[model samples]
Structures are given as structure tokens and as C-alpha cells.
Target: MTTGGIARQVVLRAAATAAGPALLLRRWTTADADALVEAYRDPVLRAWTRLGVPDAGAAVRWVEAQRTGWEGGGRLSFAVVEEEPGGGRVAGNVVLKRPEPAGPAGEVGYWTAAHARGRGVAPRALQVLTDWVFETFAGQGLEYLELMHQVDNTASCRVAEKAGYGFERVLPAVPPFPRDGHLHLRWATGGPVPG
Candidate 1:
């Protein structure tokens, strides 16, 4: 399979969490299907997310497929959960998926729930995910990391900037939208890679 195609197969297992401000990144499980459905079903989430699944049942099946990919060695998909302020369930979720090839680098895609907006969740989760990706996959010839957000997603742009991703370019009329015109902001981290 192609690198990107292979990446789609890999499922990222959960990472350990320690005390003092932690961002728990883990692989999706059957247990999380409900949470995934609930989060993705939100209208705001539906707007920005690129998920292809049509319903909750499909979401569950998708997670299962990702698990199979995890067992293989293709892609990494993670769920971001933060500890509550006082003590309870995690606030919500932030997700990062590793794209294949990424042309000498890795591409990251992320999203945060409506309830978790403006809480710094995306930035924190992004930092952890990016650091881990670079460290663990350095041997894979990765030189940079890339992220993209719709022109209208100011909040996402802020997170990318805060996380140290520099603006690289803008693609006009890509990923066309029905109403708003197409415009995408591309951001990069680390540095340029040799061809």
C-alpha cells in the first residue's frame, strides 16, 4: 500500500499520563464509539470535521477499522482527553491523525469539541501530539510537520500559531464549499526538508 494508504491503516495506541497538567492521547476503542458519535454529531463539529462516516454505527465501525490499522503499522489516530478542573470526566476531546508520505514530513489534522473551544485544548493537545510524532518517528525521515485550517477557522489558526506552526501558503478554491468560497491556510513546523 502507499505510505498515506498505509498510514490510514495504523492505529495509535494510548499513551501514558502522569500528574501535573497532562494531555492523554490514546487510540480509539469500541468503548469510545459513543463519545465519538456524540462529539462528531454536533453541528459545529460537522462543519469543520472531514470524517466520512455517516452515522454513529459507522463511527463505531470506523474505530474498529482504525484499531486494525494500529495493529498494522500505517497510521496514528488519537483522542485527546483532559482531566477536569475539580475531579470528574475529561472535559472533551481533541483528535490528531497522521497523514501518509506528507512529502518528507508528516501532516497533522485536529479538531476540538464545541464545549472545549477557547480553553487552550487544541494547542496543548497539538503540542503533545506533534512532539511525540517527531520523537518517535524521527527515523522515518520526517523533517517537518504540516497543518491546515479553513480560512474562516480563526480559532484553529490561533492554535496552530500558538503551537509554533508557521504560515506557509494558501490554496485558493481548494476543498470547495457550497456557500463560502474555498481558501485554506497551510502551516508548517520544524523546517524545510531536502528533496
Candidate 2:
């Protein structure tokens, strides 16, 4: 519930892809458990992230973890929702995680639901999240943002570049991730940040 006033400052911006629904970035809620689990059902998502949400109970825990992270002021995550007539549907998730509160940099992660892929959901949400991070944490000493994805994940590579996280270097293969990965970095103000 203590999300750096993010809950009160939701709706960072409204964006629409010429042919897609408007997008809104907000904090995760327990009510989103079902949707979260449903999105994770996609094999591609499960394969890449290795995060398996087998049921609503697991999804609730995942959401609760985000709340805990917020309260602890560590990882700030947003639920990317696409607006429709009846209501808003979750399109993706974006998160900015800082292991050290006053660290010079933080890491970012994101995923677009199967239904929302190819609709520009990942890049749009990531851009909003990156801007928010710089605006909200620059004064706290956060100077840069980093994004990493396996080299084989072309979709993620595109998302990283589209969001302006320029390639920094290659990361070593680690456990759970047998493949080498690419590290993309963006400075607080002077980097390849998109407009």
C-alpha cells in the first residue's frame, strides 16, 4: 500500500497505438490475480521469465510481493492496463528494482501478455516506467537504469532498444539462464531515452 505515493499518482500518461486501446500504468492489485495467472499461462512467457504462476493463489502471492517491495522501497512495479469499453484489461507488467536505495543504478524487467504482444504494449509501458524512475529516484541518487535479456530473446531485444535502453555489454551465463545475455543501459537524462 505504501508505493512511494504511486497509488495516488497513477495514470502516468495515456497512450494509444493508432489501432489499439489506450494504455494506463498503475500499481498491481490483488484483484489482478486472475489476470496475472492467465497471462502467465502463455508458454512463451513461462519459457523466457521462468516465473510460473500455476494458479490464482500463486498470482496473489506474486502481487503481494510487489506490494511488499513497494512498502520496503526496493522494487517498484506497475501493471500496464489497456483500456476498453467495459473496463481495463492487463496488457503487461513493468518493474524498476533497486537493490540499494541510494545506488547509482537500478534494473528493469517487463513482459507483455500474449494478447497484448505486437500491439506496442511492452515498449510503451517500459518507456513510462523508465521516465517515472528517473523522475522519482534521481534525487535519491539513482543515476542509471539497466535492462537485461537473453540474446536469444529477440522480442525482448527489440523492446529494450525501442524503450531507449542502449546496449551496454554482454552478461555471463548464470544459473537458470544458460544463455548469454545482453545488458542495456540508460542514463538518468542524457542517454537514448525516447520522447
Candidate 3:
């Protein structure tokens, strides 16, 4: 799909690591707004992200925000889709945010659709995004990526670990995040996954 404001669509693919199917990661198009709005309908997703995407309009705005981030040269996001003979479908979303144009650190976040859960979509999509950020932003300056999720979000904990993000610390509840969070880190090198 064509990405708004994105000069070149960066598609990241990872082959089936096991029984899970191969997956494709690409920019979220306006067409995916409906899927995103539907995804936010899931209570599980809403509670975690604390997002108020109650309709298509909000989803469109959200998609536009991602595009703005892309055009600004930071905060990359993707619509994780599973490739199939029939075609690819939105499996989830993965974002690598806060990589300042001249900074050394960034953050990673992702969520799997209700239908795509338990198939290793979160971690796989995360791995693909992680790899692309560190490589594609070569001169922009990147040394590490952090992932923070509520301590009770065991699924995210698993995704982080599976994606090779080492448990860094426990973060106190702050504003939007009501519960303590687990901060996971994956360094550019000399850490888990080794750059």
C-alpha cells in the first residue's frame, strides 16, 4: 500500500520462524484506518495503549500522526501484515519512536490484533522494526531502543524477551501509565541480539 508522506515504503519481512506464517511490515495506509479503529475496539488494546480511538476519524488522525512522524525523520510505525496466498491482512502494529534526529536512543512499542495473538506476531514484528530502525537511520544516530510496558502485561513482557530486549528496570506509574512498567532494552551492540 502507498504510504502518505513516505517517500519510499519500507517493507520488512521475516520468514516463518516456526509454525507461524511469514509476515510483512509496511506503512499504515488510510485504508487501514477501519482496521485500526476495529482493533482499538478490543478492550485489551484500549486498556494498554489508553487510546481513545472510538471511530474512523480518530483512526485517520492517528494514521496521519504516524505519517507526520515519518516525514519528520523519526518515530517510524508499521502496519504488520501476515502474507498469505490470498493476500496480506493487518496482524498488528509496531512502532519505533523517539529516535531524535541527532540522538542516541529510541523506544519500541507494538500490539497484536486479537486474531493474530498467540502466533508470535508481536515479537516477530518487533524484531523486524528493531532491525530496520538501527540500520535505516544509520547516520541519524542510534545506540539503543527501549520498550516499556505495564508490569502486569505479561504478554508484552514475553514479546520483549522473545525479541531479545533485556529487562532493564521497573518504572513507576506515570500519568497515562497507571501501573508500574517494565523497561526493556536492546542495545545497538554489546547487548542481547548484538546490533
* Candidate with maximal TM-score: 2
The CA lDDT at 60 in model 2 is 92
Residues 57-134 of candidate 1: C-alpha lDDT, one tens digit per residue? 887897877676555445566766664567323334434344453445566767776666666667777777777677
Worst 10 residues of 1 by lDDT: 178-187
For model 1 the TM-score comes to: 0.72
Q: What do the candidate models score in CA lDDT, each in turn?
A: 0.60, 0.86, 0.85
Candidate 1 collision pairs? 6-74, 7-74, 7-75, 9-69, 10-69, 10-75, 11-69, 11-70
Candidate 3 stretches with Cα past 4 Å from truth are: 1-7, 192-195
Q: Where is the poorest 10-residue window by lDDT in model 3?
A: 1-10
Could you give candidate 2's per-residue lDDT for residues 1-195 as a string of tens digits? 335544544566557878578888888999999999899999999988867888999999999998888877778888999988899899889998987887888999999899999988898889988888888776888889989999899999999999898998999999989899999998987764576
After superposing candidate 1, which stretches have Cα over 4 Å from the reference? Answer: 1-21, 52-55, 84-103, 175-189, 193-195
Candidate 2 global lDDT: 0.86
Comparing candidate 2 with candidate 3, which one achieves the higher TM-score? 2
* Ten-residue region with minimum lDDT total, candidate 2: 1-10
Please give the lDDT score at residue 83 for candidate 1.
49
